[model samples]
Target: MWPASMPGSILHTAEVPAFDPRTGQLSLASHDLISAPLSLADVFPPEYTLLFDPSPSRPYGTSTSAADADQPAGQSRRKRRRLARPDETASPLDWIRHREKEATRSSTDKESDEHHAAIEAELGTAVEAVRAGWMGKGEDAWMGESKGRYEWREKEDEDVKEELDLVGLGERFAPALDEPPEPLLLSESRSTVSAAALFHRIVRNDGSSCISLDIEVDASEATPTSKATVILPPSSGFLLSQLATWPASAPSIASLGGEKGGWDVLIVDPPWPNASATRSSSYDTFDPYDLWKLDLPTMLGDSPTLVAFWLTNRVKFRRLLKDKLFPAWRIQQSAEWYWIKIASETGEPVWPLDAKHRRCYEGVLLGYYVPLGTKVDLPTLPQNKVFLSTPIGHSRKPFILDLLRPYLLPRDRPPNVLELFARMTLQGSFRRSATDEDGEGDQQKPGIFLAVGNEAIKFNIVDGSAAAGSVRGWLRRQEDTERVCAAEEAV
Candidate 1:
């Protein structure tokens, strides 16, 4: 009889089969057919592999033996041994010996549980005190009390100045601390010329003016990648490479001037702090002085024209710009440009709000001042054009070139233009560096620092001359010629 421990216990006593090629069959015992023997061991790993490894499979029969059935409660059964080879057999007594330890372990667990029960009964009373202490609260835990007058409070943030107590009441009267120092303005000189004229100068100076001059081809004749680094000249007819060039173009103004340079009109956009917005969300850094700290004071010193400062609608920024930034730069108010940014999506008057007589418009304060020697004509100061006013796009300003054109173009012109806090380039505008000192080609393009087409952008370089050769001289002569011509006509 086959042992029940083996799954699908077989009782085969058949003879071996031989293949018959002619009939395409096999002779097993006596008959032949097409079927071939497919052993169970061929379909699955042998039972011996499962036994030695003690693998509990779902489909296969249990590995237990008769010793397992007779084992005591809680006793684990020993797996029935598998034959190593078909010819090998196992003794029944071997199975009983393997399950012996499991039977002993079952009996020991039963005795241990009985002993644990007696110990629990003896210790039960002590456990109650432990539970009570954990659950109890102190007498003062929730005691109610009236609110005290001595309680601390947050101080009101009022403008009233407090009288501080002095160490020696009579002798040590403290003078109020000096008002906080103002924002430092950029006093370093930057030369400002017409944005268009500056663009031409760059073109002529770069020698790449030929490409722009080549009228035969369309504007997009050259692939953007190919012509991105065309060289040009400074607006001053100075042999310096155009600010729009590749590797050679990415240097500082200090490096550009070698030692000395100055600006006529200092246009600036200070990154003043906005309390309502987070640093990341706001296009500006939280630190208002960051713009001043960038050495602007040294950059805007006593230029011929004014410093146009863009201020947000904030009390703090206005104070810094008026009292601190402009003063430090030696620039005074010449005029103002109001940029009313309307929302493109919802063009319902973005700037002007009748509520506070507030327009959706922001202000660009134009401050003007001349250095010790240079002369400027206030009357002739071109009406400060409304350079840029458009609906707001995250951080976009209106294209201000049209507004700037009048002030920039003179009867007798001047050289080069300088743009501060610019995103893109005007054909002639020499935009301030917005990238790493060594970064090439206006990293943010089409927005600022764009190259100009071939045009004769005339400019007069101021060389400390009071007469015709300088910007002031040309202005004086133009006014004189106009007056003389007008007088002759009147006569």
Candidate 2:
């Protein structure tokens, strides 16, 4: 069983002075400079290392006045004003936020009573969990809220925001006509370039251009028995073809039901068709059920392998998983968990808990696929449990591996980890996370952390502004830590 007692803070974060967004750019003082290269754990301390007094996520009230009346006032009205609040002086950005909020709130209010009770109970659980963890929404990052708001929200997202589905690319192997698609294969693996001497270093001075260089970051460590394998993008037709043949590539996929050489844990973050751009903005929304084409059962390791599915707040999507998707995959329904996105400065939900536009919290449905084995080796996850983290970017998610580590198969067995629609790298950068800083828990052995998606390497590059020939890209910012990194789209 998982631990019963809860700690005060689940993850450790670096506290830095807040940068005032009223002014145009990210200045040096406000930024927490990384003296060295970062590893996956350094960017987002999985657990042991790493806010808010918000309403009970299930829609408090729609009074705009009541919303801002309690929020702290500041000098820069535009930057400090809470999101979803509308006013005469508000700009285009404000109105966009307002409309989205209103739509969400209205819909949630009209939910059928049959489902309302369960939604209400789960949401209330998230609110309490966040409030307990926030511990007064620590005051240090208050000024930096402005920078955090647009941290990795680069101007380039407008250009190719729509995703070209790799899963359903059924063509006659026709390559790009204009200029032969020269797939760039960049590898940041355990062998070359340890985290200490990184090719992708980060710096946050005034002059940084947001460029997505095709970099394959392989975040793996060398244990005696098993060696970790990272599958990254080739950035062209090759990538699509490569992913299409994933099932055939592994002989283990031969038997979807019988436990041969299959994965121990499987995570799915499908691009559900929805109106909002929150995460779906970048991906070309398509029939989510298309995922069955991959033949999931062929990938299960042993009996009762863990499977976690991320879903939006939409009831239809939730029902699809509980009803259609799970049954087809033969996965037994289990626990549901929620992740609450809180403001770094205010220690409140980035958006209202049950805002009309978007809810600050999303859910994860956990289940076990019982195959040939009689029992699951992993411990049980709590039902309707909630965890909190500062919002990073439109798509980035915190490393849940840390929370689930203890419950996973022991290091020697080295469970195969697989993630679908992983817009960002699971292990993050292939750089060295400082050993001294990550000395808390026992480290994971050389296990496969395969992150599969069209934009799998989309958020894997190091992001930062350029100086006279310093490292070009560096991850912008992490969920709670002062350090930053490139991450991506999901619930």
Candidate 3:
């Protein structure tokens, strides 16, 4: 059914409106922000063990709601529990009782309904406007190809098994080059000596549209893990491939944050321990307090950095970011936003606004960060905003870099960004990766922008070729290794 309200134009803005009748804050379409040119394995079951080296964990301290505890020796980091909903799976009599119980709490129900109804009205109208703009007026509309839900639009897929052993790619590294290489750093190593050599084989290109990149992440072996080609979604797709080789001269751990004069923007999405996970074998979450180990303040660039923290609906997590996390980093929490998951066909939130088990929206907390002594002026932050996107892959969020671009400092070039605890990625990271990394002075004009993550690239270990056959994953990085090596030998 068509929405009751006619679609209106959506204004993607940088500054928060003093007061606008239509959706108090800026609302955007997630789809338009992340229109990747190719299809990709939307979700890669997180294997936290293989990510880049993390700072040494700090001594556990006593804090309320954030106890210092460790996962049992032989257990997984994620916790799982069952949610019993009599309304969804209960017997006819039980269902009646559940409904009756709800009716008995009239005041409570009325207040909740009224609150959510307002959210629905405002958010729904904004989403329809943006979605319609992207879907277009007629024949060029994206939805024309699909009468039902788009196969690519759904958030998660059960059949795409993500088992991988990246080490296998060592065999595919480009044959030892005959000439001396450029300066290289050892800190970028993946797993072991073999993995480091494999990383050396990675090839990067900052010239393409940054809409996408084709890297051969071969997962070959006799066991369950085999070789498979992957298609990473836009921005991230292009950025991660370049990040694979960007750190040839990266600074040390102590220098990571300020070395580049701190990141102009930092997007942190901590995988807080929760009962809801696509699969138990996916990401490894930690106690909320452990996030302190990251020491984010150290990661900031010298200027004001915009921080976007993705939060679950849980109030405790919200409190953690606003009260504890923000204060710790001297970040001034400014506004709250929402990322609503909608159905591709209807542009309606996939779930009811007030669903008890889970709301159709996730909360996003935005803030401006400047260290205690840093004197950079902060920009006015946006308020009460929401971006709507159809879900894809496991917890894969829409690429938000472009949406956040307006707030980036300098306004001349893109912000130097950091994606802390990033998984599949904070979308659109790669769009600017192709730019010269010689810092703010580089005269290179901005082309397109994209994204990357700590564990941004994943290989399923199945046998096959990818769409971009011209690209070779086996390309080698020409680096001047500081350490001596035995003469190259056959694998």
Find the candidate with the highest lDDT and give its number.
Answer: 2
lDDT of 1: 0.30
lDDT (10s digit) by residue, model 1, range 239-296: 1112122122213332332222344344555445554335345333336665454444
Alpha carbon lDDT of each predicted model:
0.30, 0.44, 0.42
Listed in order, each prediction's TM-score against the native is 0.34, 0.54, 0.54
RMSD of each: 43.3, 15.3, 15.9
User: Lowest summed lDDT over 10 consecutive residues: which window, candidate 1?
Assistant: 31-40
lDDT of 3 at 309: 89
Model 3: per-residue lDDT, tens digit, 1-491? Answer: 11111111122222222354445664432322122111121111111111111111121111123223454522321111122236344458656665676668656445644645666665655555566555534332322222111122112322333334333343244335532143223222121222233233212222212112223343345323233333332222212212223233122211343433446666667666667763564565657876555555544535577889888766667777888878887887466777766554444566655455457777778888876776766665655566755454445555456567666666444355555544442222222332323332343322221233324444211122233222212111112111111233321
In model 2, the worst 10-residue window by lDDT is 30-39
- Candidate 3, residue 21: Cα displacement in angstroms equals 13
Stretches > 4 Å off in candidate 1: 1-264, 275-286, 294-303, 343-348, 355-359, 379-388, 408-415, 429-491
